[model samples]
Every structure is written in C-alpha cells, then in structure tokens.
Target: MTKLMIVEDDEKIRDELRLFFERYGYVVACATQFDHVVDEVLSAKPDILLLDINLPYYDGFYICRSIRKQSKMGIIIVTSRNAEMDELMSMNLGADDFVTKPFNTQILLARVASLAGRVRQDGVQTSVLNYGNFSLDANKMLLICGERSCELSKNEYRIAACLLRERGKIVTREQLMDDLWNNHQFLDDNTLTVNVNRLRRKMSEIHAEPSIQTKRGVGYRL
Candidate 1:
C-alpha cells in the first residue's frame, strides 16, 4: 500500500485528508509539528507528500527544496495560493504537481495515484537513512558524510543500515545478530563486534562525528 503524508497546518483540512486517504487503503501520516517538516517527512518515509505552501517557520517551497536535496519522493503542492508563479516555483523546486485549495477530492486522489505510479516507474531510490550529518545509502552500501563517502562491506552495511534505521533507539544485540545471520542461527558475538568496529573506522575516515554509541548490555544506537 502507498503511504501518504499531509503537511497542512490547518487541523480541519489535515484531519479530513487523513481520513479520506485512510478510507482509500493508503497508509497516512499527518505532520503534527510544523517546525521540523522535513525531518518528520523523512522519518515517516512516505511514498507521496501533500504539502501546503503557507506553513510556520519555513514555507512549503523551502521544505520542498530541502527534501529534494536528499530525496526524490513525490511532492504535490496543495495550497490556497493559485498564482502562476507559485506553481512554476513549485515545479522548479521538484514538486510533481500543484493543486489549489478547495480541490476536488477525486481529482486530488487521482493526481496522487498518478504521481506515485511515476515515482515507482522511475525507480528513484529514496530509501536513504539520514542521521545527524550522515546519510546511509543502503542500496549502494555507501555511508555518505558531507562530500565524502565510504563503501561498506556486506556485513558492515547491514549492521550500519539497521542502526541508522533505528537511530537514537536501541537495537538489541540479538536483533543485530538475527539481521546479520538470516537463518536464525547465532553468530559469534566477537564477529558482530568486529564488523561494528570496522564501520566506525570507516565513518571516522569521512569525519562523521558522534560515532555510533554502544549500549553495552543492550545494543547500539547511532
């Protein structure tokens, strides 16, 4: 099922859209905090975004450009601003489409469906996990910190991917082992330790600060 995120600040419109999309079998997430729109959207990892131009802190144009820098997710500018310049600006900032306020619900749904299809067709890999100043490209097995990037070994990539996906949260040693060895068999603890140390060293080579922290008896957190 496609996941959709609504970034409108109006509570009424946000709720209505959430319910409408939920009824249609789309997994929906609404932005509760306007200040960190990009972080919220990235954390949700939605397939499409229904964004409003008038927002607190930063406008939708700024948010769209910021997201575009790291992701190619579908963005539809749903705003009250009907100016031609607004639409053109949205397109220039990588928005897939623009729909003015008081839009036809059916037409909006159709646009989202169409854009989602195109995004999938393009095979745009937007599964990057951003933690602090680092972005982990799981698909390419690359750990990117600013302009520097280091390729990861298969085991190192899997471990880093897991930790970054659950950034700031504890990923249990048992869970890490399970992810490393998919057959349900336990691997030596020292092997997992070695792989993690190697990933840390690679991260240091690129000057990625605040290295992965170990939770000792628990697990690890990035």
Candidate 2:
C-alpha cells in the first residue's frame, strides 16, 4: 500500500483526511510535530504528502522546499489558499500537484494515483523518446542531446513531450490544453503559453536543436 503523510494543523480536518484515505487502502500518517515536519517526513518516508499552507512552526512552502531538497516524494498542496499565486508558488517550490480546500476527494485521489504511477526508484525508467540526436526521458523529466541535459518541471515536460512526439506536425493550443487537462495538469491558455516558453528556454539552455516553433495563428510545432 502507498504511504500517505498529511501535514495539516487542524485536528478535525486531519482526522477526516486520515479516515478518507484509510478507506481507500492507503497507509496514512499525520505530522503531529509541526516544528519538526521536515525531519518527520524524512523519517516516515511517505510516498506522497498532503500539505496545507497555513502550518504552525513551518508553513507548507517551507516544508515543501526543505523536503524537495532531500527527496523526490510527490507532494500535493491541499489548502484553502485559492489564489493563483499560491498555486504557482507551490508548483515553483517543487510540489507535484495543488488542490484548494473543499476539494473533491475522488479527484484528489486520482491525482495522487497519477503521480504515484510516475514516481519510482532512481534510474528506474531507461526508455527515452528520441528525435535524431535530441531525446526526452519521461521518467526523469529530462531532455538531452549528446552531453548536454536539462531537467524539466512537470508542466514543461508535458508540453515538450507533446511537441517532441509531433515534432514536424503542428499542434493546436486547444489540443495541447486538452491533453494537459486530461493528464490532471489543469492548465489554461496563458499558462500553456508560459509553459511552452519555459520549455523553449530549457531546450536552449542545453542547446538542443530543432526548436519548438510557433505556428502563427494556428499553434506550435518542433
């Protein structure tokens, strides 16, 4: 069974979460020591973390950053902070997913399952999708060519994979957004653009060629 850690301060809500996940066959654990959350998480070594932003000693953002520096465990922010900035900040800080409070548990479960399926031990995925010299290893979220390599974030990886797969073929914005949404990314048009731009920058950083090209009023292609 997957081990799930809940880093929420509210006892009532925390209990509710534990019960819900327990019903779904997860080995759930709660962080009682708010001040030592980082150490507790490191010790427990849960497969996934349900984090709340408003914490006692250290907030979710701090704990997220701290844990990310040490582990690759998936993190999903489950908090009442609904601002776009909060979601963006959480992702920027290495959270794999973000869900606001009053969330549908079923949807949250789906996200957790999806992330769980992607994560594995180090060097687990050896397969790579290639285009001439450039290649993408979905497992590591890495884009590589020769000796140069650049790590990709979740959204950036999705966008790059799509474009790389359809390298010479044009992909519309609607198509890209729909694929990301289907994958539990929940990205908007503007957000897709931002992700694409970031992907381009990462590709440039490694000097991987056959850059993703804009299709004027249509869409984008490699």
lDDT of each: 0.82, 0.82
The clash count for each model shown is 0, 0
103-217 in candidate 1: lDDT tens per residue?
9987787677556544631356444545555666757879887789999988888888777556556899889999878844345798888988999999999987558898879
Best by TM-score: 2
Model 2 TM-score (2 dp): 0.56
The RMSD of every model to the true structure, in order and in angstroms, is 14.5, 13.7
Off by over 4 Å in 2: 121-222
Listed in order, each prediction's TM-score against the native is: 0.55, 0.56
Q: For residue 72, what is the lDDT in candidate 2? A: 87
Q: Report lDDT (Cα) of residue 194, candidate 1.
A: 90
**Candidate 2 lDDT, 97-185, residue by residue in tens:** 99998988766766775565555423242235555347787768899877899899999988887775565679999889988999999
Position 130, candidate 2: lDDT: 55
